[model samples]
Target: MAEFRCRACGQEGTWVYDPERYTCPACGSIDVHFVVFRHELPDDDPAAKRMDELATEEANKRPKKESED
Candidate 1:
């Protein structure tokens, strides 16, 4: 239920969703809105590719941990 997009920073991902006020976790902007959730899309779907790219970028922004376990 957290499929959202940030209009402030263009950050899109499940983890970027803020439940408190639907603000952007990345940019702390309330200019975020929920988009249609896609369970599956074709390999050539541009939306899917964009989502994947954003997810990867968000993942890279996190601090790396040597070991979590």
Candidate 2:
């Protein structure tokens, strides 16, 4: 896990692994950069737990628009 700081709001948080884009939550800015090698997280960190929860929620929120099309 990596940490990232929002340039706009200066709020620090964990980095999310997204293939599309990397956006900051603090200020909703996309001008965020990775703060590499800042700290090491344990296997049971709260941020990791929150990430898992968000992922699960997103997966469940996906709309099933079509069957086979």
Identify the candidate with maximal TM-score.
1
lDDT score of model 1?
0.68
Q: lDDT of all the models against the reference?
A: 0.68, 0.64
RMSD of each: 10.7, 9.8
List clashing residue pairs in candidate 2: none
Task: Write the residue-wise lDDT of candidate 2 on 5-62 in tens digits.
Answer: 8887788878654434467756778878754341344436665566678878998999
RMSD of 1: 10.7
Query: For residue 44, what is the lDDT in candidate 1?
Result: 58
Worst 10 residues of 2 by lDDT: 34-43
| lDDT (10s digit) by residue, model 1, range 1-69 | 457689899988776322245577678798987763444455456666888898899999998999989
The segments of candidate 2 whose C-alpha lies over 4 angstroms from its true place after superposition are: 35-69
